[model samples]
Target: MIDLAPHDETDTTALKERERFAQILVLFGRHGLKGLAARLGLGAGGGEPLEDTRPEAIVALLRDIGPVAVKFGQILAMRSDLLEPAWVDALSKLQDRVPPLPFAAVQPLIEEAIGGPIETSFSHFETEALAAGSIAQAHAATLLDGRDVIVKIRRPGIERIVDADLRLLRRLARVAERRIPEIARLKPDELLRHFAESLAREMDLSAEARASDAIGEYLKTYGVRTARFDWELSGRRVNIQERLRGFPASDLDAARRSDLDLATLASTYAQAILRMIIINGHFHADPHPGNVFFLEDGTLGLIDFGAVGTLLPRRREELVRLGLAIASEDTGGVVDILMLWAGDPDVERVRLEEAMAELIDRFSNVLLDQIDLADIFQMVFAILRDFHLALPPDLALVLRTLLTAEGFVRRIDPAFDIARELAPIAKELMRERASPARLRGEAGKLLAALGRAVLSTPNLVGQIEKVARTGSITVSIAPKDLERLRGRERAGRGTPQLYPATLAICAAIVFSSQPLLAGLLAFGAVALAVFEGVRRR
Candidate 1:
């Protein structure tokens, strides 16, 4: 029997929820941030606020709260753009090291997953756990055919616990966001969503196995290795993969102690990361040193596939445009991209453009080699915060991955320059972009969008005709504009089919394969269609 001072006390009607709510409140009050707790209506006491102090206390509080909080902290650590340096530094030190459960506790679960006693698949399984985290545990074992592998098993009932905790966190984040301006500005709710998505994927061992297969195979060209999952024995809760022999990427001393070409390894690591993001659009979201291993056979071994991010083709193009715009100080292009990400429609464009100019000035003539990417991006985010703009979740993940990848590689060799390596990749990408194949692809995309725009037009026409006959929807327009819109309709009625027919012909070659073009064409195409509609008003 416990009581907590949470704001929505009346809603905790469920007996288990009330207990967990009280537990969370108790942990909050015990761990500092009394002011934050009070502000969120979860505590009776008040003290310094979340922004005022206690990075260490916050880290301790997260660890105490459990794995979900640690996972959230891990995300926050990668977000130096949105968090204070002290908080970032503190949270980065929170490791996912937890005491392992007895082998007996997980044996039944494994036996069920493998469809028989462990002896059927594994020749020799270690009774002692190799590693344990909040969601899963691992054990060293030999397969029936005598190959070494790591058997990872999800902790029994962890799914239900994680789901309940996530729901609680969502409510807490929403409450905190509404009550605290600092928390609102930090976008706690959005961060929580990102964390929850990744956590769910992490818990799904099958999804992780697939990611390992894709990313591992892709990295082979760059001298990187990935553990291959034993698919026949893998399931949603259990997965076994070949054991990789390597030292952790963080073990710089171990790396130096070996005769490997550290610089070459560092370059390949950075290059692979960029290619995945820039070219392939799928990437390991967290390439932190801890998740990477320098293997015995001169290849980097990457692990932990629970979280990945994707940038669609258009997003990749926008990123490239943004980079070129920043490099060339193209204020209009920069603002155009920023407006897409502005959280509020009322954001002042003139002010935003002026702010962009100042940011550009900071790096005006500096060589790319001399620029500190992390500093530039941090400043950009700070300005976006000032302007009430939020980075799209995918782009934020990209930035975090870039920062982590850079840091990971730089740790291996201090003199390694990612920007320097990127110049060549950039050139190669340019060549690919200009290739005849790319030109044909781009052309095909345009005509397919044209077909979609034309295909969706009849719906707009039906609405217009319905309004004309029944006035079911309200219409607003200037009288003179209305007259002009009417005037063009009668004048253009005979000429409408020329382009539509041409579009039909061109789109036959393109639109058949564009079935998944879910949204309307890009904004420019939408604007053209809207302009046409308005002209016929």
Candidate 2:
């Protein structure tokens, strides 16, 4: 028997809320509500179809599920590939319409997070939230020293609810993995782990503050100034940052009024994204329109550093190679780079090659100026889907951000092409391949790897001979032993243990036969054994 009871005092309310939500699911199912209602178990009760005209009912159900589900729906809305357009449109409304926590309830949280009274920390503060998102809300305020800032406070009880929901989700994911073979292809368990990490980061305001400061410093190093919030007054639950007064980038009317060059601004923004990816190897994972602003001076302001993407040095290098391969229309090179990054050499190389070729053919004839970023991205995503390639989470986030930024840029300036803007950057990166310093470093690395392999070759050969003579091998198995063994067996043409077990059974059969028949059976067994050994080797 599993204990489903709440573990802490703070979790009791969340547990009750979840039970209520379950009841609501049953009621909705009983009334024959929407399809999603049935999927959510809201339609568990048997009843006549109910009228679906109640938008309020839908909103109420979402609110009852708490902040994490609301946020999930909001993000799902952005993934047009995952849901119907109508559903996406409906969920987009959730962006600005999440119910705001009461003003009285919010002030105390701010004071508690910052310590002491709200007045002591801020010269003036707005009681009402300036904006309300699923996880947190931002309020306008002025520091005691007179600096304008915005204070972001996490909604009360959100962390508790999120933890409960995620625990349930993780359990569900494990069940899904066991029941669905296709789910393993997508790595549902790893995806859940990623979601947990992202949610945890979002809940920690201190982490976001550090990310913002790091990005700001990186930008400054490149002589690019962007809006960043002050973290001196920030804490785990509260983030106080310099208030930025700017129009949303999507506001075309304001751009015109301010005489901002949409094309130049789009180019600059695209460049900044490229820099974040290629130079720093760290980038804002979410660059949706709502998270970016355009100031009157044409400086782009990026906010919400909670979600970020980071690539390991090796992956970064592979990405550089991939970018070059794309630019040069080298389909084979692109496929090779993808295989290296995938960490699975036995994956269907032919399928990957074909996918890469098709993707390259789609844009091969198009000039950089004529290539729309969205179209290129759609082709790449199509290829990924066709090949069933699972991208690393961080890499996937980077691609999503780039796609979103391209869309935003296109909306602002119809003629601004992100592909064209990135062409020169891509060319420069490709040129790095031939740079003397780069070539020398590559040579050194290659020599060092070869040296290590050469030194180990004799010992490896000796071990192989010893194993062959002894008919046994002593291998230290680690946590990933099974996966590593499977890979080695596939690559080395080695027989799995099951094959040897079958051979042993054949030998037993021969031994049990009569003397005359046994001799013939022994010959047959030897022949089968030879064939099996030759096939395996």
**Candidate lDDT values, in order:** 0.77, 0.65
| TM-score quality measure for candidate 1 | 0.78
Per-residue alpha-carbon lDDT of model 2 for 299-371, expressed as tens digits?
Answer: 7777778888886667667787686678777665686666554555455555566667677877788777777
| Residue pairs in candidate 1 whose N, alpha carbon or C atoms collide under 3 angstroms | none
**Residue range with the least summed lDDT across 10 consecutive positions in model 2:** 44-53
Model 2 segments more than 4 A misplaced: 1-64, 73-97, 181-184, 221-225, 340-348, 431-437, 459-537
Residue 283 in candidate 2 has what lDDT?
A: 80
**Candidate 1: worst-modelled 10 consecutive residues by lDDT:** 515-524
**CA lDDT, candidate 1, residue 89:** 89
* Local accuracy of candidate 1 as per-residue lDDT tens digits, 147-243: 9999899999998888887878888888878777887877888888878888888999999899989977888887778889988899999999888
What is the TM-score of each predicted model, taking all chains together?
0.78, 0.73
